[model samples]
Target: MEIIVVIGGPLEEGAIRRWLHQKLQQKDNQKFQFIGVDGGCLKLMSEELPIDLAIGDFDSISSGDKEILKNYAAKMIEFPSEKDFTDFEEALMWVAKSYPQQKIHVLGAFGGRVDHAISCLWTMFRPELQALIPYLSLEDEWNHISFLTPGEYVIHKLEHTKYLSFISTGSVKQLTLKQVKYPLNHQDYDFPIALISNEFIDEQMEISFESGGIIVGQTRDSWR
Candidate 1:
C-alpha cells in the first residue's frame, strides 16, 4: 500500500507538479490513497488531483473551498483550531495509527516558514511513528528524506545530486559511512551534521550506527 499525504506547505517547482500528476495517475495496480491536510486539500483540488480524505482545522482554506472539499472528499474531518497538534501532525498521527504497515510518502512538507519546515522534519520522531521511520519520508521536488534507526542500511544514491546529508537532532554513537566521498567510522557527534557535498562512490552506500537515529536527506542544490 502506498499513502501519499499532502500538507499545507510551499510547492513551487513545476517538476514537482508534473511528478505528482504522474503519481496520481499510477494507482491502477496498487492500494493507493491520497490525503490532504488543511490547505493541502485546496492545493490538490487546484491541481485537479483526487483527494481521498481531508483532515485539519481547515482555518487556512476559504469557506467556498471547504464546501467544495466536503463534496469532493470521501471524508472531511475537522478539529478545533486550538488543538495541541498542528494540522500535519494530526494527519501524520492518523497515518501512523491507521497504516502502520503501509509505505507513507509525504509531500508539501517543506518550503515554508523555517519553523514549519523544522516541524515537518521533527514530526518523524514522534514516539508512535518512530517504529515506522523506515517506511516514511518527507519529499519535495529535490529532496527525499527518511529517518533512520540504529541499524545498517544500504541506501541507494539519488541521481538528483551527489549530496547526502545526515542530520541528528540528538547524539549519534559509532556512526559509520561507507562508499561515499568522505567516509566516517565510529564517530560521535552531539549536533546535526549535514555531511554535505558527499558523492556516492558506488551504486550503494552503507550507513550504520550503534545508537540514536538520524534523518538522511538525499537532495540537490540546483532545485533550491
Candidate 2:
C-alpha cells in the first residue's frame, strides 16, 4: 500500500480531485493509507475522503474540526504542540518507522511560509528519513516533486506537465540528460544548481547521474 501524507499548505480542491481521480484509475487495485496532519485532516474530511491515519498536534485545528477528524479517521495520534519537529515531519517519521517500504506521496506541503516550504523539501534528507528518499514525493496543483538517486532513469512526461527541471541536492557528477530540448553530456555540477525549464522532445526523456542526488520537478504554468 502507498501512503499519502496531507499537510496544511495551499490546496486547490479541483486540482486535488483531478489528481486523485487519475491515480485511482491508474492503480485500480492499489490500496492507499491516507495520513492527515493537523488541519490537513480537515482537508481530507472536506473532500469526503477516508482518513486511514490522522496524526498531528491538533493546535492548528479547532475542537469541532478535531471531533470531525476523530469520527472519520480510522486511527489517530496526537502530539504536543511544543515539539522538536513540525507536525509534517512527525508524520513522516512515523511513516518511516511503521511503513518504511511503502512509497509516501505528500500533498499540501508547498506554499504558505517560505521556511516551511524549504523545511518540507529538506526533511526528506533527515537521518531517519534518508532511506525513504527515492520513495518520497510531493505534489500540488502546479508541481510534482521527486528525488532521484544515482542511476539511469527513463522519465515519462506526466500529463499536462509542460516543463521538467532538476536541482542538485548535493555535489553531482557525470550527469547526462537525453532526448530533451536542452540535452547535456556528462556534465559535472560541484554545487547545487537548477537546470530549469527543460522540455521533453518526445513522450519520455533519459536522466543519468553517477554521484549525488537530484530533485526532479514536473511542472505546469497553470491548472488549465
Candidate 3:
C-alpha cells in the first residue's frame, strides 16, 4: 500500500481542496491510505477527505480539530508531546515498521519553521529508518528531495523544472553525470554548493557515484 502523510505545516491555505482534487485526479487514490499528523488533520478534514489514521501529539491541532479527526479517522494514534521523536519521525517509524514496502509521500514537510525543515531533512539519516530511504520523499510546493544510495540512476526531468542539485552525504569517490547541461566526470562533491543548481537540458539524465550517499533535489521556480 502507498502511504501519504500530511504533516503539521503551513499548506497553501486556500489550495487544499483544489490540490486534493488534482492529486486524486492523476492517481488512484484508492491505493493510498491517508495519514495525518497534528494540524495536518485539519487540512485533510477541511478537504472532506477520509483519513485512515491520525498520528501526532495533537499539540499543534485545536481541540475542535481533534474531535473532528477522531470522528472521521479510522484510527487515532497519540503520543506524549514530550516524546523523543518529532511527530513526523514517529509517523515515519510506524510506517517503516508496519508497511516497509509502501511508498511514502510526505506533504507539508517543509516551510514555516526553518529548524523544522532542516530536522526533517536530517531525519533521513536516522539509523533505524535508513533502510527505507528509497521509499521516502519529502515534497513541498517547489521541490522534491530524496536520498539515494550509491548506484546508477536515471532522473527524468519533469516538465517546467529547469534545475537539479546533488549533494553528497559523505565523501564521494567517483561521481558522474550524463545528458546534463554541465556534465561531470568522476569528481568529488563534499555535500555543499559545488554541484548545486545544475540545469538539465535533456529529457532524462543519468548519474552514478562509486561511494557515499547523495541527496537529489529537483526544483522549479513559481514563475515557470
Candidate 4:
C-alpha cells in the first residue's frame, strides 16, 4: 500500500489544490491512503478526498473543522496540545507501525515556516522511521528532497529540474559524484554550504559516499 501524508503547513490554497490534483494523477493513487495532520485535514476535506486517518493535536484547526474530521475520517488520533511530537512526526510514527513496507509521500511539508520545513526534513531521523529511509519524500512546489545513506545510488533528473544539491547530514568521507556538470570525488563535505548547488547535465546522475548521511535536493529552476 502507498501512504500519502499531508501535513498542515502554511501553504497557499492554490498550491494545496494543485498538489492534491497532481497526487490524484499519480499511478499509485489507486493504492494511496490519505492521512491528515492538523490543518492538512482541512485541505483534504476541501478537495473532497478520502481520509483514512486524521492524526494531530488539532491546535491549528478550528473546533468545527475537528468535528468535520471526526465525521469523515475512518479513524482519529488526537494528542494533547503540548505534546513532544509534531503532528507530522505522529503521523509518520503511525505509518511506520501500520505500514512498514509502504512508500510514504509527504506533501504540504515545505514552503511554510522555515523551522517547520527543517523539522519536517529531520523527521526522517526519527528512530522508528530511520529504517524506512529512501521511502519518505518531502515535496514542495519547487523541489523534492530525500535522504541517502552511505552507498551508491542513481537518481534520474526530473524534467525541467536541472539543479541538484547534496547537503551532508554528517561528516561525509570519500564522496563521489558522476554524470553531472560539476562532479566531485573522494571529498569531505561539512554540514552546511559545502555542496550547495550542483547542476545535472544528463538524464541520469549517480552519487556515492563511503560514510555518513546526505540530503539530496532535486530542484527546478534556481534557488532564490
Which candidate leads in lDDT?
A: 2
Please list the residue runs of candidate 2 whose C-alpha ends up more than 4 Å from where it truly belongs after superposition. Answer: none
lDDT by residue (tens digit), candidate 2, 3-93: 8888988787765567777778767888888889998888888888889999999998899878877889999999998999989888988
TM-score of each: 0.91, 0.91, 0.89, 0.89
lDDT to native, each model: 0.82, 0.87, 0.81, 0.80
lDDT of 3 at 90: 93
Output the better candidate (1/3) by TM-score. Answer: 1
Model 3 over residues 1-224: C-alpha lDDT tens digits? 67888888778865555544545665674477889988888888877777898999999877887887788999999999998999988999999888887888788877679988878777888887887898898776567788888889998875535689887766886799998888999987655434788988878999998888788888888566
Question: Which ranges of candidate 1 are over 4 A from the true structure?
Answer: 13-16, 21-31
Q: State model 3's lDDT.
A: 0.81
Candidate 2 global TM-score: 0.91
Taking the tens digit of each residue's C-alpha lDDT, what string does model 4 give over 1-224?
A: 77878887766666655765555665553567899888898888887888899998999988887887899999999999888887787788888889887887788877679898888777787677787787888876677888888999999886545579998766888899999888988887665434767988878999998888788888875355
* Cα error, candidate 4, residue 129 (Å): 1.6
Q: Residue 224 error for model 3, in Å?
A: 2.8
Q: Which ranking of candidates, highest lDDT first?
A: 2, 1, 3, 4
Off by over 4 Å in 4: 14-17, 20-30, 222-224
Residue 32 in candidate 1 has what lDDT?
66
**Candidate 3 C-alpha error for residue 147, in Å:** 1.4
Clash number by candidate, in order: 0, 0, 0, 0
